[model samples]
Target chain A: MIELLLILCIVAAIIAIESKNLLSSIISLGGVGFSLAIIMLFLSAPDVAFVQILVEVVMLIILIRATINRDVTEVKCKREFFGMIFGMALVTVLLGILLMGIQTLPEFGTALVNASAESVPAKYYIENGLAQTGSANIVTGVLLDYRAYDTLGEATVLFTAIIGAIAILRKKKTNE
Target chain B: MNILPLFVTIPLAGAFVVSLFDFIKDEKKKNISTNIFASLAGLVLLVISIKVIGSAGVYSMGKWKLPEGIVLVLDPFSGPILLITNLISFICILFSFDYMSGYNGREKYYSLFFLMVAGMNGLVLTGDIFNLYVFLEIASVASYALVGFGTMREEIEATFKYMVLSSVATAFMLLGVAFIYGFTFNLNMVSVAKALGSMEAPVGVYVALGLFIIGFSIKSALIPFHAWLPDAHPSAPAPISAMLSSVVIKTVGMYSLIRICYVVFGMNTGQVPEVLRVLGILSMMLGVLLALGQWDFKRLLAYHSVSQMGYIALGFGLGTPLGVIGGIYHLLNHSVFKSLLFLNSGAVYYRTGTRDLKEMGGLGKKMPVTGATSMIASMSIAGIPPFNGFWSKLIIIMACIKSSHPWLAFWAVLGSILTLASFLKVQRYGFLGKVKDSLRNVKEAPFMMQVSMITLALLCLAMGGLMLPGLYDLIFVPAAGIILDQAQYLKLVLGN
Candidate 1:
């Protein structure tokens, strides 16, 4: 089942990248996101799946808005043959290196330990997260209490994006 | 008392307040209120940073232990960077008081500026790798908007390019973080270091390191990944340009790269330093070569930023004690003088409504302050003796020769000479020649702008004093020491 979902994701991603029509590409991208979220759900990460779905929806809307009334169908595929070859070679080398590195990882779902031979932080968080943060949802507890600084930074990113959009899109006032 | 959280919180709260000022119908009230709040916030940060110097501790959130909660670490390494970040930010905000008035949306501008500042401060102080990424994105996103704030064709185009490239870099960084977490089961820097230190690095770890290096190299605007900087830096408003060129790249790029390479991966004597050295040389030679041909005043400075960053990278990549000191010192000096140069260019833009050096000349008589400050900055950056740049460059070159890499030292000297030539062009064509008719009536920058520029210029002069043993021990020595001894960081953050 995971293999099927993974293949679906790959197909959708390829379709999204290769589709000439902007709208179709966006829909294909949405397909990829939906499949990925399902995969997350299967992995027993409902919170991640939920966030992924919501983000996918928002992204689709944004892509739609950006593409609306635009002649993006003209999609110029200017292939620089040398550049393409170089890119392919680089990707191949990177993947080769990455594959070699992956061999050293511990087998999947194994109990991981720190250098001190103690259980990793995840074990501690799982056992004590609720008591420490007073939140029922461990994810929320972790995000808001245990790691609220990261949340603050995330909020700042969102705020910056909004302000940046407004700063860029606002019509200039001439009274000054 | 845990004052660490305030470093992230105060600027964030200031950003929120500045955003609220958008409701004010009166422009004067809005402007004055936002400026005061932002500057006050900056002043508070500066004070806190100064107080935190020479102190190293970890502040875990919600009273949770380090292994269970996100922590903010204030080691000797983070100390100097934090100080530089806040000090430059405060001065930039003060400078922008008069400089930013020409642009629209002053309220949103200050809001985004503070947001960027918060992100950078958090990035500098955070002990978790994932937390660093979050803050990195915050700062990068804000800068993207700031770059395109003008809404002009070039500004929008540059912002779009910067956004795409930077987002790709961030994505790579996230993947690298995931790789580390998958293997080590740890997200905190100290924990990750502790984990990796115990065992031989596997393939996954190497891949993760590669991703991090590429991501950070892109962020730092090192050669081959630096195409976005020339376009993005020159298109933004002057203060934003100064901040981006001076603090943003260093904090997000070089600082993080150094932290990961030295602390987490522990590449003290290996292939990593050699890669860094090669990249550094490439950036230094290529950056200046590219810079020598630029005609736009700000664009020229932007290219020079890449070149100067090369020097910093080379200094650190030498993997020697003196090299690290030189790198850290050069980072500080570059922030002072490079921002001064950009601000000088902005002053020229403000007065004559042009950034084309070929179009203006003989402005020395009209704007003595800008001219004098620009000259100081130019000399400092060109590695003239008695200036801050000279001392740092000398140390770096000496470190290079000592490390048995005389070729790198020679490249360093050549880069400096080319830098001098480029600035001489700036001085000759932009400030010293016959004044064009349109620029004849141009006046000096406003009082606040002059104050900031002169303050930074004095900083450039005074920073030379940092080379003295007394101040060196106080500032760069600790930072360099931290880089040299990663075990100290691990012990400090996660006590044995």
Candidate 2:
């Protein structure tokens, strides 16, 4: 049943992406994101759902702000629309098959559980996540405690990006 | 406290310091002072990164214990990337000293530049997925602002498009992480990898991979998701063009993709490599095809960045030892040469004030340093003998043939020739032609810029030496070992 809903959402998204008006297209994209978030929720991932909602909201705000002064129907050619639809369908079909294939796998998340259950380090997080990290959130604990180097790299990427943006966009003086 | 956190803090601090100086009345003094400070700070960072690499371990922030607090694993893998991040940043800062004089507000530029470095370093070191999301945003948001830094129509347009796509991609990744966390009831990668590894694979896991692939692909600007790059990369200042092409996309986009695939999900996911391979092929062909027609020198180089990245992806996608080694080696090689190419373009722009190939004529007679360096880079990128690019590309093609994928080998060589053809166009139109009278007075770029280009160009020459037995052990082997020892990674992270 949920698979059917996912298909519908994806199809609708494809349609929305083809909308002549940019505003409508953006809205349709939001719809697709909303449905994907719903699917995530159905998969028992409330945390993911919440974050997706936050992201979707932020995206809408940014897009609307960015496009408000511009024409909604500036330059949407039929060929481009067709190409976009073709691309979306290709993605949808590919993902559908991949998802089905994933469903057939026997030891998806189970391997982590079995391995961690026996592993001593896994027992450490299981018992003392909060005690070690001083954070009640296990997610935060795991992020901060066991894999902080990855976090550092991730943060540095952001920092570099901000700098790169400033360097690229800064205005010039009118001396000439 | 281990000094890993300082890698991020100093840059953030630098950004604020530079921004604060922007309001100063005398912009010239401000510029000079800021340049000096940024360069000094970059040197310090270079030293510090070397130190961290020498003595590596898991650094839990604020003395927090593992699993309870944020941790930073500073091992060999993090070492080289961190080293590259700092080294490239220092060179860029040095290059910017003269190049940025054309633009205004030097202090702000230096600060933001350092901030971007800091973000990349933090991203490379961080352990948790959510933190990864935050740092990804830091790098991405900063890059968006940088893409629009020019504020011209094309620049702003590209930045907006990049920003929207990237933001949406980040949303998907965050959503994926949230799902992983809620489902696994854990957040640490080792824990999550362990948890996900143990559970009967759910529908959500595939969704997570989808989210990650889309996000990282967009970040990397792979073919289908690559509309923003050609526009954005060229629109930035030349040094920034080099930085973006060489480091930003690779570190944020490719690195994240590989780390997630190998570490979080494990390479056992049957379809993931196939997906990567398909994307790799698409990017390889499409990026080169699109680049062939471009008249803009920088834009052409930008597209080639995508193509070279494709070569890297294709090798890794092959999923063999030789393939992985070739991929990583090409990755390092590509970063060096591509940055050199971009810097070479920057030198031309500094002299000619234009990126259009048609407008440039006979630059070789005037700018000897730049012309020679560009030729070296063009040869390196085209897989000419004795350069680092040749060896890596040869390895990738050989790996393909060894894997019974001769067609891929054919495509790889075809791509290299195509790359050479386009760069030949750059040399012909932009550098080797009759010297345009208007640019006759144009001189070489400032000394520092020349020095940076020369250093990279020389590296292009010496990189082939990396294949020698002694050099390979120090650098390539350990990195390759990381990819080869997938099970060992899982064990180290999740085991006794």
Candidate 3:
């Protein structure tokens, strides 16, 4: 089932990448996101999937708004050969990096831990997270209680992004 | 006292509040209120930072133990950096009183400036690796917007280029943090360091370190990764340029690199210092060499920033006590003179409305204050004796030779001479030659601008006093000790 969902993701991703029309490309990107959200649901991460779908819906609206009235079908730049070569190079480099990364990760569900290690933090999180944070959801416990500082930092990053967008897009004096 | 969060909080709150002033219907009233309020916020941070200097402790957020929640650490090492960060930030806000007024959305400029400050302060103070990455993004994002604040074609283009490259660096950093988390299941740096030290780290750990070094090298604008800086720095409004070139790169780039390499990974990480040395030498030679040909004054100074970060890198690259001292010393001195130089260029542009060196001439007579300050900054950056730059460069070169990397010392000397020549061009062409017919009516910068320049110029001279044992022992020596002694740092944070 996971394999089927992942293959769907791949197909949509490819469609998105290959689409000539901007609207179709964006829609295909939405296809990839919706399938990934479904995959998250199957993987027992409902909260992430729910957030994913919400974000996907909003992103689709914004992107579609950006593309609707534009010359969606016209190809702007004539760089097919160069683009193809660069894309191929990027794929090769990414594959190399993936292989290198895979070598360091543990086999499937087992913990990525030193085999000789006595302990890991997950054990404490599982046993005490409920009592300590009073949240039945361990993910919430982790994000909001134990690692709340990171959550605040992430929020600040978003704030910075909003201000940055406004700063860049604000109306300038007419002299220019 | 758990005052660490204030370093991040005060400026962030200041940003939020200052942004509110955008709605004020009265133009002059709004400008006066926002600028005064921002400067006061900056002054408060400066006062608190000065009060907090030389103080060392770790404060865990929410009273949570290390390895469980976030922590902020201030030690002998981070103290002076913290001081300088606030000091320069306040001065930049003071300088921007007039400089940023020409642009629209002056309220947003002050807001973004505070955000950048908050980000850098949080970055320098945070003890968790992931938290550091978050703060890194905050600072980088703010800087990107600030760089393009003017909305001119070149400003937007520079911002886009900067944003793209900086995003790449951010990806590298996040991946590095992820790799570390996978290895240790820890986000707190002390815990990660402890875990890795005990485990006999694998290839992945080294890979993570490599990623971090590369990411930071790009941030620091080392030679090969430095295409964005000359454009971004010169395109920014003058105060933002001063902030970016002075504290932003050092705090977010070089400081992070040093912390990860020395305190977290330790010498056993292998090849870290050597990599730093090679990169340092390259940035030093190539940056100065690159600067020699630029006709724009600010662009030339921006290139010099890249070169001088090389000097700091070389100082730390040696892994000697004296080397660390030299690195910290140079870091302090560069912030002083470089910002002064940028403000000088800003004044020139403010008066004559051009950055072309060929367009400038001996309006040194018209703008004596700017001319004199630029001269002092030029001399200091060129390593003239009795100035702060001379002491730091002398220490760096001495350390290079003392470390028995005599060839590196030779390259260091050559970089300095090239730097001297480059600034000579800046002085001779931009200020000292016969007054140009076009610029004859140009006047000096405004009162506040002169105050900023004169204040920084005074700092450039007074920073030489830092070499005296009194101040040296008080600041740089112990700062170097914290950087050099990994065990003490871990102990300081973790209370081993």
Candidate 4:
């Protein structure tokens, strides 16, 4: 069941990327998110499903709002056939690799995080995270306690993006 | 407090403090304080980097154990890079003092500059692959903003193009990092190196390595992935052009690529060096060929950046002790001279308000300082005797011959000769002829700009000394040693 949903997600994502028109691409992207949420729920991860649904809905609405009263038609360019063929070839190669990787994984529902899986990092985190960090949630302990520096870097990246938007979008002249 | 974190923290705090001054109503006051803070931050980082040379340590973040947490390692490899990034960035700040007077929002400029510095500092220092990606984004995004900071139509267009390509590269890098994690289940470079050494790696790991190479090649503006650099470098303000062309590409692009290939994946006995050599020679020839036709001063230099990076790559491709040393020595030399050349161009632009080669002639007589410094720069770039560019190029060429790839040596020498021809064009037509009517009244660049140029020019002369036996052992040997031996790096980071 999860494999079917994941395939659906990949197909929708491909459509989202390959679509020329903005509106179709946006809808295809929504298809990806919705199927992903379904897969999450099926995998017994309702918390992730809930968050994904909420975020996907909000994102789709925002994209639709931005698309209103604008031309969804893409500007056609010359030599697009070769470009499309090239892009398709790349996608096919990447997807082939993805499928190969998937074939080698453990059983679909096996919990690597909690399983006694030969001393993987995730298993170590699951076992010792609560004891060392004093957090009941392993995710919180890993994110905030162990790899908080990465969170700092992530926050800085966000801050830089905001600065970029401001720098790019600012008015030419300031009010005296 | 170990000094590793301060390399990043100083710049981050400085950027924030500079941005806070944006609220100041008086432009002059705001500019003064921001510039002062940015310069001081650069100075402090430079001093600390200098102090840490030849020292190695691992600073674990949040006091967590090695495998579970983030670590910033300062070894012989990263210490010099930290020095160059800070040193060149410090000079750029000085150059911007006068050059940016015409532009508005000095506060925004300095803030973004420091942020870019902070990002690069973290990128160079971090041992975790995922953290490297995060910091790479910070540096890249800040650079995109800086590229378009002028908000001119051309600048904005170039920024958009550069941003698109670089975003793609960063995505490739992140995907590559994900693959590394999946295969080895390790984030730390030392640990990942250990894991990959023990395990029989799958096909996916090689693909991930391919992805990593492509990502960094794009960042460094190698031959095939080099379209955005010519546009982006010229479109940026001069100080920024200097930074992007000089240290930014080296740190985020080639440095990451080398670190991953050597420490994590192991470079010996692979087809990787063969591939890099081909790319290097291709970039060398094509970059110079494309540069030979350019009329725009900055664009021509931008193209040569592609060519110079090729030499460094080719040196690495040789995979010998002399080859790697030549690669690294050229890396330092290229950083100084390229930044100087850009500063010279920026100084020219400041005085004359033009970037076209045809618009200016014989201004050398009028603007003696800019003329002289640029002439020094041109000579250094063209590989004249006693100048820094000549030595590195000679070393690289010799390494090629020593490696028995005399054809590669032939190509290196040919590339250097073509480089000379193009720079001679710059000198003859752009600087040394009759001063054009429009440029008649042009004077030397502002004092601050001259200081920056002269400092770099002096570096171009003195760097030849670095090749001497005394400094060679202290600096070049260990850097090459680290790049060659993964075990030494592992022991440095994760001691037995």
lDDT of 1 by residue, B311-428 (tens): 9999999999899999998999999999999999988888888899888899887899999999999999999989999999999999999999999999999999999999999999
Question: What lDDT does the true structure give each of the candidates?
Answer: 0.89, 0.78, 0.88, 0.87
What lDDT score is found at residue B492 in candidate 4?
Answer: 82
Q: Candidate 2 chain B: minimum summed lDDT over ten consecutive residues — where?
A: B487-496
| Winning model by DockQ | 1
Candidate 4 chain B: minimum summed lDDT over ten consecutive residues — where?
Answer: B261-270
> How accurate locally is residue A146 in candidate 3, as Cα lDDT from 0 to 100?
81
Best model per lDDT: 1
Off by over 4 Å in 3: A1-4, A80-94, A112-120, A174-176
lDDT of 3 at B328: 92
lDDT of 3 by residue, A1-176 (tens): 98998999999999897777778888999999999999999978999999999999999998888778876564466668987999899889856864686578555557633432124555566777898889999989888988887787788788888888888889765133
Expressed as tens digits, the lDDT of each residue in B245-342 for candidate 4 is: 99999999888988888777986446888878989999999999999999999999999999999999999889888998888888888999999999
* Chain B, candidate 4: TM-score: 0.99
What lDDT tens digits, residue by residue, belong to model 3 across residues B245-319? 999999989999998879888862347888888899999999999899999999999999999999999999989
lDDT of 3 at B277: 89
lDDT per residue for candidate 1 within A19-58, as digits (tens), equals 7777889999999999999999998789999999999999
Candidate achieving higher TM-score, 1 or 3: 1
List pairs with backbone clashes in candidate 4: B362-B433
**How is the predicted docking of candidate 2 categorized under the CAPRI scheme?**
incorrect
Write model 4 residue lDDT over A1-176, tens digit each, in one string. 88888899989998887677778888999999999999888877676789899999988998888885686456355557888899889989987876665454433456464445243557778778888899987877887888888878777877777777777777653221
Clashing pairs in 1: A101-B203, A101-B204, B362-B433
Better of 1 and 2 by DockQ: 1
Model 4: share of real contacts kept: 0.42
